[model samples]
Target: MPRSQAETPENETNSHAQKALSLDPWEAAYLRFETPEEEIQKFIGRLNRLGAPQWPRDAEIVELFCGRGNGLIALQRLGFTRIEGVDLSPRLLAQFKGSAKCTVADCRRLPFTDRSKDILIVQGGLHHLPALPGDLDQTFSEMQRALRKDGRVMFVEPWRTPFLTFVHLISEIPAVRRISRKMDAFASMTEYEIRTYEQWLGQPELIKKIARAHFVPVHEHVGWGKWNFVGTPR
Candidate 1:
């Protein structure tokens, strides 16, 4: 049976997620790898879908929780200029490459002024938020507040489908409880699990509804244990 709106997971929390040594512990994980080329193309396609004459090369963009700015490297190649990364750790920001400014800050509370940004991209970052509806909801509102008129937003979040969810639980058990949460086991696991809260696992519909509520959703794509959204800020 398909999950009804009422069946959407809510108030889900895991004590283990809070036990992370660094909230954004991606410093070690993304410190070395380049963003997947396929993903870069996917994002570039979505961005190109937005502006008319041609994809605006001068768009002021930021990637929230951008660990080491690896994804920004890919975005730069896609014709985006004035790209910046906002992260919480200076250590992670230090690893960033490409010609981009890096800011150490919280995603929920951005440092930009109202309507200061042309685009906001949260690539593989939303799932790390505190696993509560309120927390997710606030993050959405903050993203909305940061956008200029006609500004677009895109999020590439981890998805949790049933089999993937099971894989995620197994991975989380070993990675967080047993292995000290210092590495990315999901990268090593062949299973399609996305390391995120139960509410988000395999729940693309819920993710769509959440984004649509805060903005006018332009497109949504889900597959490979990931959910991607492109939207116009409302």
Candidate 2:
């Protein structure tokens, strides 16, 4: 996405915020390597592991930071008919192939009415937010506002696990990058997200604390460089 011309200090701030919150050009380009079929199956596996099979198929669902709508397609395949997606990147949203409604909007400021949504899902997105507790708090608050009393929220994000630490340590080695195609790709992706990724990984405990403050936990798993959390509005 092109940055808006900064006519004033406020515009500069908005530009910075947009940079921090949305995928950069290179990151968006990397997404093209991900096939729709593969992404759908990958999301299906994640949802099943997160207990999505128990969720009401008819419930209204919105996915924040939904890039290319693979997760939305996965939801449809799982029998969900009422689904929508919100993201800041029009370029990524344009790649969506499914029937779900897609909206270009910031996740911290959702467009849905109060208590109107039945579920919200976010995958691999929150780490992009630069502001730590404040941005996280605002996003969760917005989530609560959009969710019904019984509504649930689910997310999968990077965590600072031992394996991840080790991976990052060795990912810097020239030999590893040249020898492993997967590692090479991973390194390229992480290079684009290094700033925000470091910020988010440094506060894993705080992230969990903030999440728990807004929602009653239904399920949570932290390991293998990923944090998967499921909860209902408090």
Candidate 3:
């Protein structure tokens, strides 16, 4: 997969390249690996912390890298109506069973017009990008461009905390993994994208710094092996 260039035009050529980059391992196993109810609960908690409950039901919202649309489902359950999703994998997007429009597009080059979206959300997706600061920075730039001046961005991604380290250590134990379905699934997922996962894990602070540079922080939480962030465009 090519490293995503900043402000790449949302054209047919770019779209094809982006789709080629979408050869994600999770695309094949995500449905089998995740428990939808549990995933939705996690998304609900994150969205609530981002003040989703206070937002109007008709607010325009888009979720990038929305694998299988669990986050979209959470937004729907919260009463959000004008919701949309974007991901590179068509197969994963096909699994989405919601009213929101789903598009196959690269996060680094969003299809939306400037200042057109009210809110942008990403859950457990950034860490999948192979390129660290570059791809991540490009994605953030695209996000800022696509969002309205007052638009908000929310994300929850894996963090390299002590608790996460401990979980990783224990997850290595076959017996422990067998006893915990969540752990087993997590282990399997991480193993599938270990290279990119480890790249993100080693630089949690850098990731936060990049995000902070793009948006002014409104809320931030780093714990439980996750970095939850909410911000408005700078």
Candidate 4:
């Protein structure tokens, strides 16, 4: 039998998108990467609105592909103490916040019961998943399934803009690379980062279309060098 649409790798991504498929050791090392503290605060502030009227202090929240559970800490500060994180990397999970639970798993196949979670946060993780053409839908399906009737997802990913595209390209110049190496943040490139970023171009728009087909968009944000979405399952 032919593979189901969910199982097939669609002609979804172009040749350049091939980069989002897998991660190497250095790229794997990159997964344990730290998220800026201010980003965490922003997520909390968004949630404050997301949870408006009632804070949902007891809501069970989870971050898919969470690295080091930095986001879990943000939820804690907002009084949502029942938070969890899931990722494929044990190394990242090991560094998760003290009270948050961490699980090693794929976002396409979450272990949670149907409609068990209240909120889902995907900070900087949306673009790094399976880059194959048809794979993005599977991830979206799982995200919707894991949510309660009112469950929602918030996503923040690096934006694919011409200026940033030029920036990444110029940063690759040998002279620029040498100078960047002097500064730790841009000191080196991860094979994984390079590949997925190439595939991520134009994804924010595509994600919005797919999200609206199955869910409703509470907000669609694009700017600040990134794209963010607050979506609720339909």
Candidate 5:
């Protein structure tokens, strides 16, 4: 019998996902193998083109699911001040102590008041959302609610086309599949499921949801390096 979406085995106890975040294996592999100089330059170049620094230098910026403070650290170097980083990993947050104010929490239930931020940045966070069978729309609404009017949310997502192809190739690799299964087994919440979590993820529908939340797209750029989706609160 063919597997049904409703019958798909849950990997809420995956240990690898519990170790940090439920990272796209492709992105995780690239992060593990590629040089930071190459990745950072590629990221910054695209953001620079998109006017990612449009938020005032003194404005409060929040980096949701900011792992190890990489984005926050880099943004600080670029003149951003009063930055806050939030994530679920205590180990990751602990390493960021003194570098920035790091909060360990879930993005789905952000602990900030409405209209609390000037610029909200979410890098590879939303894909982690639809992984489970819970309230995705509500979570997006919460994110929208947290942003002040005129606030912007920037996301770097794997283009859906490429993500599908990547998943197909990786599923053929035995070792990778084995490791993925083990990780899925150790996950504690549906949030950590790696396979179904990654399948068919994209930004267009998400952009539409953002629109419903009273935001409008400022840009959608598919560059040689990465795809960026930027939206401003209405």
Candidate 6:
């Protein structure tokens, strides 16, 4: 039988996006090789520090944009059960659902009830949207509505300035350039959807949005110059 649309890789081109199709076995293996274990550990430790104290006891955790179930697996390893993974890709979600529960849907229009989960995680996923003024606030509000009282949302996003610079400097290498071009990746993106993201680039606008959504910033860490925000719903 022919591969399903969800099983086939689309004509995608981006330096970073190719790494996201964690559903493909060879592609997944390549990304695993590229991933820096030490850096990943440090990032997880940062998340651990911010989340440990506030983590609900065996609470229901929801991971949004859960590409390839990496974060879900990580949380499971960390002793969190009752986890639901949500993603936009059907193949990825299907693969994850084989061993765990997951849903395929948009984050803005979550299917679950309001304040249903104790923890929500968006890892390297939120920044994929068009960065614009007010867009972050909109996303934060939606996340808040999806969380229970005192629920927490953790996001790991590129820090814009440094991240862009780093990618630019390193992407010039022959291999990186080739991979990036093949992946249709750009060094930086300014989405036409929200001009607010343009003006607020590299700023704490994201944090401010979370705060406005009644989420208190409980922790922040800068690793590989990336920003990780850990906040609690008020």
User: Which one is best on lDDT?
Assistant: 2
Give candidate 3's whole-model lDDT. Answer: 0.87
- Model 1 residue runs over 4 Å out of place are 1-26, 30-54, 162-184, 187-196, 202-206
Query: Over the stretch 1-234, how does candidate 6's per-residue lDDT look in tens digits?
Result: 998565555633442365464445533432343233433464457557666545754888888877667667666666666888887777556545335588888776787888888888887666545554455666677788989887887877656666666755675456775666422233222222124444444466645565546678787666664677778887
* Per-prediction TM-score to the true structure, in the order listed: 0.69, 0.85, 0.86, 0.74, 0.67, 0.68
Top TM-score: which candidate number?
3
Predicted candidate 2 versus true structure: per-residue lDDT over 40-107, tens digit per residue: 99899999999888888899999999977899999999999999999887878976878999999999
Query: What is residue 58's positional error in candidate 3, in angstroms?
Result: 1.4
RMSD of 4: 13.0
Candidate 2's C-alpha runs over 4 A off are 1-24, 175-181
- After best superposition, candidate 2 residue 123: deviation in angstroms? 0.6
For model 6, the local distance difference test gives 0.63
RMSD of each: 14.2, 8.9, 10.6, 13.0, 11.8, 7.2
Between the candidate structures 1 and 4, which one is better when assessed by lDDT?
A: 4
Q: Give the per-residue lDDT digits (tens) of candidate 4, residues 1-234.
A: 887665555544542244333544554445333344755776667666554336478888898878767678877777777889998876557655568888999887889888899988887776776574456688878888889998878787778777666666675577776555322233243344667666776566676677687678887767746776787898
Stretches off by above 4 angstroms in model 6 are 1-46, 161-164, 175-207, 210-212
How big is the positional error of residue 40 in model 3, measured in Å on the Cα after superposition?
A: 1.5
Candidate lDDT scores, in order, read 0.68, 0.88, 0.87, 0.69, 0.64, 0.63
**What does candidate 3's lDDT look like per residue over 188-232, in tens digits?**
777898999999989977998899899999989888988889899
> What's model 3's lDDT at 166?
93
